[model samples]
Target: MDHLYAMSLDLNALLRDWPFEPGMLKVRKVTGVDGREKLQMRIDLGVLQMELTGRPDGMRPHGCESLLSYHQNRAALAKAAGNEYELSAEECSELQQEGIQYYHRYVSLFQLNDYAGVIRDTQRNLDLFSFVDEHSQREEFVWNFQQFRPYVLMMNTRAKASLLLNDGKFAEAMREIESGRDAIVEFFQKSNFPELVSKSSEIAFLDEWLEEVSEKRPRSKLEIMQREMESAIAKELYERAAELRDAIKMLKASK
Candidate 1:
């Protein structure tokens, strides 16, 4: 056997040290041999490695940052030349394959709590979907990628809301979640799939998450006092309600 080939084929020690868990997303960041940071995901068979940025596989298709960027530039040049451009079936397939590379990296990034990276990659995929939808030569090609749009939108929303949540802005996070849900609904409606509004798993996940976050959110002192004042007024306790109202006024004035 060739020595270099044998060495390249061996991964027994690496696999032994990091056993894969069936249902867990095992990911870690490490410096590559070339001294750049990279991500690794443990699978049942072995580990899959990805670059930290710029086209997860580190390939610049057609000398562009990504296939989508290359195609977009092509479309722009075509328009400038007074000619309409459309993607061939082969081009659409190639773009979809490139998208999978991004999908893997973003999913791993999300697990590693790198929400910004997740947002970046997911948004890129969404752009790819839109570009393909508008320029693909066939409706079937458009649907092939459009079907995953809701799930991508959901992940993008979660990442955005999570960044706000990390900054201790629960109200802002809730608003972001609501906006994200509305976007998904709009997508369904635009796709003429209004009946899917109630059955969408992405919407369901956000709904449940919104409830969970709302329940766990901390109430401000003003909110507590206002609630108490409302209760007092409802019970006809004029004196108590008047005292609470005075405190609320002072609180609002202080702010």
Candidate 2:
């Protein structure tokens, strides 16, 4: 906890000042397996520009960091309460000092056989951290976040389409969906967790629920309508999943 207060006070100052280029630019790089060329990107941020002129590979621990960073203030809390390691019933106050606080707190929790406490602490900071902390939350977020760190990378046009659909920009969204199939699929394959190719239960329960969408749908027209809805949702999913497949191909080819 030494200089804990000073650490927060100097985060920005500690953050090295890096330069950026106009418009969307790239500033992250990775060397080829043979070590000849490097992979890169070009994108705009909320407020910042970057160019990957000649970058070096730095180990990015996005897998572990995202979860830890989300509940980081917890570490600061334990610190402020004084280094009390006695494992009686007590709530750790989340204070803020360094990002490392999150790392230490969880590390200790794991060592101290605090399974329930670990899950509780993680759930408590679910939304605040990033993912919802549900099943596969770590797998889902780790892969997603790792795919686009240092440079906030985006490898597929379907990602663009997802944004468009989200923003009510149907035309653009559909456009990418239609044309970017290969790119999307390729992106998925390159991802750390490729099985996300089939996204898990978000709103897909209709397929399962409909096996018996209530015994009430015994009528002719109701059954037909339910069947059609199932077909349409499935079609939409097929198209989306196909895009990821192509993205995977492209990524592997690039490698």
Candidate 3:
């Protein structure tokens, strides 16, 4: 197996060329064995597969829960042993690096319209930040994690809002946006970093989204009927689906 692996590397080098572009990025949705939809990005080198939730590769670290879960479990064990929850800089760094990988996957998931996946990954990172802040007690480490909390909250809020909007819950989505902005502001203000809060691009984004939602025209009857038709079909309510389909056509024709 070792010899075969070495030969494969040689073959890869032999086939390699200059001006490589990593080919084109081709994306597709796939359903995993667990019956969840996922996304795969294909390139010349290889294909990258990601889950819609939990870890990007769908692998459980430590053969159980995530790093966040592992830390929490250990913290409990430490308490039982009458020891304090302690983590080195290296452990924190490792967890942070793991988070970066999930961040990449979540970005791709967002682009693929997988808002739930984005929410899952963002929440995981947020949990990590909370865990470090509570346990580490290192001022520098806490400060560094603090810098990312607002951004994580913003991303989580965006994902939640997007999901809500997809379900035609516009009011709830708008509220989520507003609340997210307020949360960021509050976090910074509490930390005595009001300047950082003011400079956040996410605050501007939330404001713009708020304005857009508030000022946007109401959905046309035809549009609403069409969405209802889709919802009925998804629910397998054929009779209701037919009614909504006809209603959509009637509304469209009247327009």
User: Top lDDT: which candidate number?
Assistant: 1
lDDT of 3 by residue, 35-113 (tens): 8887766546655677756667677878755677887899999999999998789878877777776777776777778
TM-score of 2: 0.18
TM-score to native of every candidate shown: 0.88, 0.18, 0.69
Deviation from truth (RMSD, Å), model 3? 11.4
- lDDT per residue for candidate 1 within 118-226, as digits (tens), equals 9999999999999998897688999989999999999999999999999999999999999999999999998967899999999999999999989778989999999
RMSD of each: 2.8, 20.5, 11.4
- Per model, state how many residue pairs clash: 0, 21, 0
Q: What is the lDDT of residue 107 in candidate 2?
A: 29
lDDT per residue as tens, model 2, 107-167? 2343344333333333333333232122123454443333322111111332344455456
Question: CA lDDT, every prediction?
Answer: 0.94, 0.37, 0.78
Once fitted onto the true fold, the runs of candidate 2 whose alpha carbons sit more than 4 angstroms away are 1-20, 32-255
- Model 3 TM-score, all chains together: 0.69
For candidate 3, give the lDDT: 0.78
Of the candidates numbered 2 and 3, which has the greater TM-score value? 3
